[model samples]
Target: MTAAITPTTREALARRIADLALAVPGRVRVAVDGPPPTAPVELAEAVAELLRAAGRPPLVADARDWLRPASVRLEYGRTDVDMFLDGWLDEGALRRELLGPAGADGSGRVLRRFHDAGRDRAFRDDYTTLAADAVVVLAGELLLGRGLPFDLRVHLRMSTAALGRRLPADLGWTLPAHERYETERSPGKEADLLVLSDHPERPAIRS
Candidate 1:
């Protein structure tokens, strides 16, 4: 069974993100939890489905890949947070980590490009980084419309079941949740959106 994110851990992460949002002007925060083997594609697909399920506005870009003339792109990878916080690396490292080039550049030119971009942020995990990037993009758009003094937060959690549930159903692979095979499970992280939806002080949706 995948170990669940304990209540304490969730609270800590939430608080950490909340603190970050409060501190950084025009910044966004996001948190995500899921099984370790979750593919990047599965993560992308689930975010798309969740947006639809939640009736969220259409994302400025398609979740599958880059959509257009956007300069800031998001690539997914793990990072050493301390090194990032210490300002040892720049955006180039982050670009290479998040999105370099489609194929291998034998000359490592893309890596050099990433290194040139100037790294302003970093994350410890790929999932969290993806969530943060989505929020950052959304936050930038919101700034153009609503102006500042706002904090944007997004959380994306994927499950082998929930993310890929539609597939097995389509393929006629009928197995109960209890009986289905699960690998690299996160164990306890249930969806937090339901809890937030029930929050009495939940923030109103912004335009």
Candidate 2:
């Protein structure tokens, strides 16, 4: 059984990630992977603050911003589980724009975003140059098992019940994708840090 956990459990995780940033030699690339119900980006933002407090610069990138344009994404129609899992995200852009450039043998400059699917256009913003020892938090769903290179990875895991219970009716279609991710990717297995995040405020850690 999981131990009784407190509200500070999430904060404790933030601090733990901050420690990784301080201990690691160069820019630490971190992946925060989970379905929206698990609030992966919330955890990503929290740790980015802790990283800043710890004096290691931090950068944040969301997977939504790297989504392919509407034409490519909606080719099969919305609510397609297969497309959501495989077709929507532009992994190449993510790697070239954010992950690769921030990695070793590359500059620390990173783009804030590539394409905004909502507007169906590309971002015209320039790159932000971070310190060489910065920490980049890339947060989103279905991020694992894709072979994206990262120094550290965290997966915010949610039980099927909790995920379905937490998500609203409009997003009910997304369940199968999340389910397949757990089965195929086994993010909990890929993650260096695993978090039980049914209750975002009081997350439990698997022993």
Candidate 3:
């Protein structure tokens, strides 16, 4: 009998293995999708480590590296929730430089970082060639439902109260964007792996 697919179980795969390459062949582009307070970066690193242990190369990158210039990002206003949901990330550059190039037929040369949001300037980094079977782990907030091609989509879900409680007071304005994301994108349904991280001590995986 076939195993019922869930967040913790695939047909022939289990949550413990973490050999995600079996799920997606050749070069894989994985999106560690979550809001900022959910800390997608940490989960990304863990995924990379698992790949490394399994003798696969995993290149961890952040979407913040491809953020649009503050001028464009803040055109409507700094706290525009719509802009936060849609316009902040430079998806075109992200596709051109990193995710697109990591595809099966794409050139192995991948651009590591493109833009620096801190100084609001471009990064001075050379292109690095990714191994044929390497995994590109891109972590960031609001990554899903944008039509980006990712082999494995892992969404770190959190409750509204959890998000508000963990998020810093200054960044409270960004909550509406996440709310919009839930209503519009339906990440829980779209994600390949869904993890409920409301309680930091123990995250529940759907059975």
**lDDT by residue for model 1 (13-48), tens:** 344434443444322322232222222223334443
The Cα local distance difference test for each model comes to 0.27, 0.85, 0.80
Candidate 2's residue-wise lDDT over 1-207, tens digit each? Answer: 655443447779888767766788888899998888777788889988988887888888888899999998989889999999988989999888889888966687789689978899999999898788888899998998999889898888888889999988998998888889899889888888778888877876664
Query: Cα RMSD (Å) between model 3 and the true structure?
Result: 3.8
lDDT measured at residue 22 in model 1 versus the true structure, 0 to 100: 41
TM-scores of all candidate predictions against the true structure: 0.22, 0.93, 0.89
Instruction: Output the number of the lDDT-best candidate.
Output: 2
What ranges in model 1 sit over 4 Å off? 1-23, 29-61, 67-135, 138-155, 162-164, 168-207
In model 3, which residue pairs have backbone atoms overlapping below 3 Å?
Answer: none
How accurate locally is residue 86 in candidate 3, as Cα lDDT from 0 to 100? 96
Worst 10 residues of 3 by lDDT: 8-17
lDDT of 1 at 201: 24
- Comparing candidate 1 with candidate 2, which one achieves the higher TM-score? 2
Total clashes, candidate 3?
0
- Local error of candidate 1 at 128, Å? 24
Model 2 score (lDDT): 0.85
